[model samples]
Each structure stands twice: as structure tokens, then as C-alpha cells.
Target: MINQKSEVKVFPTNLMKQKETTTKLAIILPGAGYTSQGPLLHFSSGHYFKQEHDVLQVNYRFSEAELNPFDTDGFSANVLHTLEETLKETAYDQCFIVAKSIGTIALANLLKHPTFHNASAIWLTPLLHRDDVYQAMLQYENNSFCIIGDKDFCYREERFANLKSNPSLKTLLIPNGDHSLENKEDVLGSIDMLKNVIDGVIQFSN
Candidate 1:
């Protein structure tokens, strides 16, 4: 985990990098109470696409265990702003975002922001509620994929159906898995689904 800190429009931004040789880049956002290192480990162990792509895991404003207090709204805004600045600096040919749980909602919020537009996204167990922000994300034009575990407490079949009702979104269900993917054996299935999504993204980019 490569830790670095910078200021983006007055907001302190912390980031971690997992470098690879490929042109593709993945901007990862962790779930609530999680750090970039957590996602970095998961991606490094499971995401074969990383072998051909660089993974940039970002630590949101209030998600850090130490040095910051939990403030959902403020952290969300910081995530959007940080992503906007990072995109400008990196100027990647094809940028893809992968967000888990709360991170997914944050990424969706970023999508709705005018300053952060036009990026493909993958949401893993997105913590979506009945809100205008969720509606706005459903209407966004970018290619999107939402992956949910069938056994996830926060996401049920009804919720999955509701999200899939959006013609623009694609959904993947991992059976008997939870929000954290605690069922270690089920990870292969999750990885397979992720691989398929990455393959689709590659085809779309080409």
C-alpha cells in the first residue's frame, strides 16, 4: 500500500497506489470503516485484471480509522472532489471505478456531480436508499454494473429487482454471499463475475 496525501480544493485527500503495467486504470473506493489497503489486498489477490491495469485505491475524508471523524456527507463530497482532481492529473485513456457498499453510493453521488461526469462504474453491494441521489445515479448514461450477493442483508432480491428496473443498469447476483464476501470459497464466483465485467469494459473501450 503506497500512502500519499495531498490537498484537493482545500480538502485533504489520502490515496494508495497498486501499480501495474497496463494502460487501463481502476479507481477503487472502499466501504465504510475500511481503508484503501483493504481493497488493495482484495484486488491484488482476486482481480486478475490488475495484472494489466493499475489500481488506485482512495481513502475518503472520514473513512480513515484515525486522524478523521466519520461525517458521511462531508466524506462524500470529498470523494467526488478528489476523484475529479485525480482524473485531471492522471488523464487515463479509460478510467473505471469500483466501489463497495457505502463507497458505491459515494461513487454514484460523484456521477451526479457535473464536475465529475462520463466514467464507467461498477458497484459492489451499493448501499442505496430511496433518495434523489440514487434516482440520479440510475439515470446516468455511463455504462454501469451492480453486483450484489444474494445473501446480503442490505440487499435483497426485491431491492436488486428495483435497481435492475433501470434499463441502463446491469446486475450480477452472487449466491450465498454476504456484504463482506466473508464466505472465502464464494470469492472465486465473485471474481468470475468481476472478470466478466472487466472483459465487457475492455470490449466497450475498444
Candidate 2:
């Protein structure tokens, strides 16, 4: 789907190019203000594409005035609307999700749909403060991973520590990194952070 402000980028695997949903798929969800074009977002999508999995990236917009990560209802509606429209024509037999920040909220809500019940996921900078996120995560039936920074104020490390016992859930904690997992003051350090993040993505998606 395409419009003035929103776009959905789909990279079909070689197999899917000839057919559809005949291969594994990776659905990417973006942060509130972060479009699917963001470095990390598309970077991960590329990884999935390289792995021979189809990719669907959602780029959407919501009114900034009414958007609040905590409230989530408006944000959720915006994301679902874009997703439903972008994916209404197809169904995937195997799908996984990669989401960041508010994207985690969107992914959590998406999990409610039967289509994604057992889909594995990768959560980046999830809003642990929101029950809908961590709570919905509990219902995830497949292996998953969550990557967050120590300096990310949106969530607490203590909340994530509680998930240590979940065998299906893997966690990566970045030092001095913020919500985007970047250390604004140390660009060099952020490279290492990015490496770790991408490594986790590769490991999880495979």
C-alpha cells in the first residue's frame, strides 16, 4: 500500500516472487515516529531477505498530538489499520515479527489475531511499562528475543529481569545506550552496540 504519508515495502523471497506465502516471512513494525526506513528497521529487514524469508515493512503515521505510548489505543488503531490494509490480500503459513519501541505495542496487539499466535518475535526497546506488551508477550508460543538499553527510560531493567526464566525469551542489555540503543555521545561505541543488536537479530531470525 502507498499514500502521501505512508508506505509498505515488501521484499519477497525468491520463492515468494514466483508464488506467495510459500516461504517464511518477517513482518517489521516501526516505532511511533520511526518509519520502516529507519536504519535499524530496514537493516533487520535486509537480514531477513538475505536469509531467504519474505519481508513486509510497515511505514505509518499517527497524529502526534494524540499519540502516547502508554495510552496506546490510538497508536494501536493506526498500526492495525495500516497492517490490515497492507496484508488483507495474503496469508502466511509461517511468520515472525521484528518490532521496535511503540512497534512492540503494535506487535503485542497484533498477537491477538490468530494469524500470529505462535509467531516468533524480536522486540527492540519495548515499553516494559505497558502491561499490554509484556503481558501479551507471555502468550507468545514460540522463541523470542528482546533488546533494550540500560538508559532507555521507557522501561525498567528490573521488569525485564523477571523474564529471565522464560526459555523462549532471550534478552540483550546494552550499556549507556538510549531508547534507540545508541550512545549519542559515543558514536564509536554505538557501532559496537549496533553490531550486538544486529547479531541478535541474525541469531533470532534464523
In angstroms, the error of model 1 at 109 is 1.4
TM-score of 1: 0.67
lDDT of 1 by residue, 57-133 (tens): 67554424542444445556677776666656654566667777778767867776665466677776677553533
Candidate 2 lDDT, 1-206, residue by residue in tens: 22234333332212222243445778888786777777777788888777767787776554565363345555555666766666677666778788988789878888777777778888888989888898766556678898999999976867888867677888888989899889999999998898889988888766
Please give the CA lDDT of all the candidate structures: 0.60, 0.75
lDDT of 2 at 114: 71
- In order of appearance, the predictions have TM-scores of 0.67, 0.83
Worst 10 residues of 1 by lDDT: 1-10
Best prediction by TM-score: 2
Whole-model lDDT for model 2 versus the true structure? Answer: 0.75
